[model samples]
Target: MKYDQIDRKLFIKNRKNFMAQMKPSSLAVFNSNDIYPVSADSTMPFQQHRDIYYLSGVDQEESILVLFPDCPKENHREILFLKETNDHIAVWEGEKLTKEAAFETSGVKTVYWLKDMEKVMFELMTQCDTVYINTNEHYRANVETETREDRYTKWLKQKYPAHAVAKSNPILQRLRSVKDPIEIDLMQKACNITEKGFRRLLDFVKPGVWEYEIEAELMHEFLRNRSKGFAYTPIIAAGNNANVLHYVVNNQQCKDGDLILLDVGAEYANYSSDMTRTIPVGGRFSKRQKEVYNAVNHVKKEASKLLVPGTDWAEYHKEVGAMMTSELLSLKLLDKADVQNEDKDWPAYKKYFMHGTSHNIGLDTHDYGILTEPMQENMVFTVEPGIYIPEEKFGVRLEDDLVIQKSGEPFNLMGNIPIEVDEIEDIMNS
Candidate 1:
């Protein structure tokens, strides 16, 4: 791992919180993600399953975390099984985690090799009456590929047909949504790295630069600062390309007078930071562009303030939609007649702003949080509101990551990044 060693207390606290919620005599198992194949003799880079990594700080593949809080044997209470490290693996793929190192990283004293998993699991299943299986249950999840966790779940179920089965996702979703102070610090580090990348573009961006060139500059900055790279696939959409949400083919040349919508952020220690900033290509926003930019910025600012504790997610979006509708009406994009005739499901503002105003952001880009539940303190969300004017051949979006506070306004993690028209223009021109 390029990042520094995180304090083990974070994982210890996470495990305690999770175990506190488990039903008595229930055991939960979490598996690390597989190294997916690209082709023969090649594979995609490994990404640790966030749930396991959250509970245990083990960031390696072929690892499993088990929580048997009520087990008869105290050693089996919290166990970590790893793909045992040796000198051969040390030379071939660098050293994997040793038993002593795993204990330090995860705070779990009991460790075993993968070879002993079946025997150890057999003993565990006999003691626990219920098994908790981790599944991809995030609201935005659309997984099709079979995972290591899936295979293990299948084997466990087939072997123990009499045991009661339960889901771990619901428990994790609620727990992972609220940020730990250490996790918040890590996310703040990611946002700081992203700020460095965005600031680099202020001077580097000018007319005639390819969109990919801007992406490259951000990558360079992120890499040098110890970030693994983008938290998610970056959208370096330039000009009309910005009208296409999720545009990633950054091939177009940024022409003079056009705006570049940079939806990019760096990842630190597997935590994510999502930000979107629309900047002028030639160091100045045109009059019309500035109007749209300011409108989007206004919505972003107001929308973020509603991310306080006790705010309902659905109601928050509705309020932001109303604010955006008024802005669109003033911009002449929507007439009063358009508002009256609009579909209830899709309002007049939908013509300009088609996506949701905000979502939970953290370990995953779209982090875990129940939309039906009211907001809670320490929950992080991204406030991204945009106006995509395809007919006008441009788009404007302003976004920032914020933490829901207890009483007042949310704390903006990306607050240091330039956002106001004057600040951006001055920096670009300077």
Candidate 2:
């Protein structure tokens, strides 16, 4: 891992909270993600499963965390199984975590080699009546490939048919949605790195620059700031490309007067910070472009204020929709007739602002949070509102990551980034 070690107290508290919610005599298991292969002798980068990382702070592959809080022995209550490392393995694949290192990384004291997993698990199964299984149950989840957890679940269910099975995702979704103070600090670090990237782009962007070049600049800044890189696939959409919500083909040239909608963020120590800012390619926004940009910014600012405690995510979105309606009307994009004839399900503002105003942001860009539940303090969300005009060949999106507060307005994590049109123009031209 390139990042510094996280405080073990965070994981200790997380485990305590999780075990408190588990059924008595129940054991929960979490597995590291597989190192996916691209082709022969080629593999995608290893990314630890968020749940496992959240529970154990074990960032390495081929690892397992077993929590048997009611075990017969105190040492067996929390166990970590890691891949055994030798000199040969270290030479070939850098250094893997040793037993002592695993203990330091995770607060778990009992560490076993991967080869002993079956023997250890058999002993654990005999002591527990119920088993908690981790599964992908995120609201936007559409998994096609069977994960390591999936295979383990199948094997465990067939082997221990009599044991009662429970899902861990629901508990995790609720727990992970609310950020701890340590986690909030990590996310703020990521946001700080993203600010560096955005400032770098402000100086690097100019007419005739390729979109990929801008992407490169951001990556350079993130790497220098100890971030792994973008939290998700970055969107360096320039000109009409910004109208396409998920545009990622950053191969186009940024022409003069065109706006580049940059939807990007940095990930630090597995925490995510999402941000979006639209800036002019030629260092100055045209009169029409500035008008649309300010309208989107206004919506973003107003929408952020509504993210306080007790706000329902669904109803909050409806309120944001109403706010967007007035802005669109002010922009002359929606008329009184269009507003009157619009469907409630698909409001008139959908033509200009289609996506949801905010989504929970933390470990994942679109992190875990129950939408129907009321918002709570320490929950982070991205307030993004945009106006896409294909007819004008440009689009404007302004987003900021915010933490819901106990009092007053939510706190903006990306507040330091240049957002005002005059500030952006001044910096770029300077």
Query: What's the lDDT for all of these models?
Result: 0.95, 0.93
TM-scores, all candidates, are 0.99, 0.99
Candidate 2 segments whose C-alpha is farther than 4 A from its true place: none
Best candidate per lDDT, number? 1
lDDT of 1 at 231: 96
Candidate 1 segments exceeding 4 Å error: none
For model 1, how does the per-residue alpha-carbon lDDT over 219-333 read when each residue is reduced to its tens digit? 9999999999999999998889999999999999999999999999999999999999999999999999999999999998888888888898888888999999999998999
**Residues 1-430, model 2: lDDT tens digits:** 7678999989999999999999999999999999999999899999999999999899989999999889999999999999999999999999999999988888899999999999999999998999999999998999999999999999999999999999999999999999999999999999999999999999899999999999999999999989999999999999999999999989999999889999999999999989999999999999999999999888888898998999987888888889889988988999999999999889999988888888998888899999889999999999999999999999999999999999999989899999999999999999
Q: Could you tally the backbone clashes for each prediction?
A: 0, 0
Residue 19 of candidate 1: its Cα lDDT? 96
- Lowest lDDT 10-residue stretch of candidate 1: 301-310
Error of 1 at 9 (Å): 0.5
Residue 104, model 2: lDDT of: 89
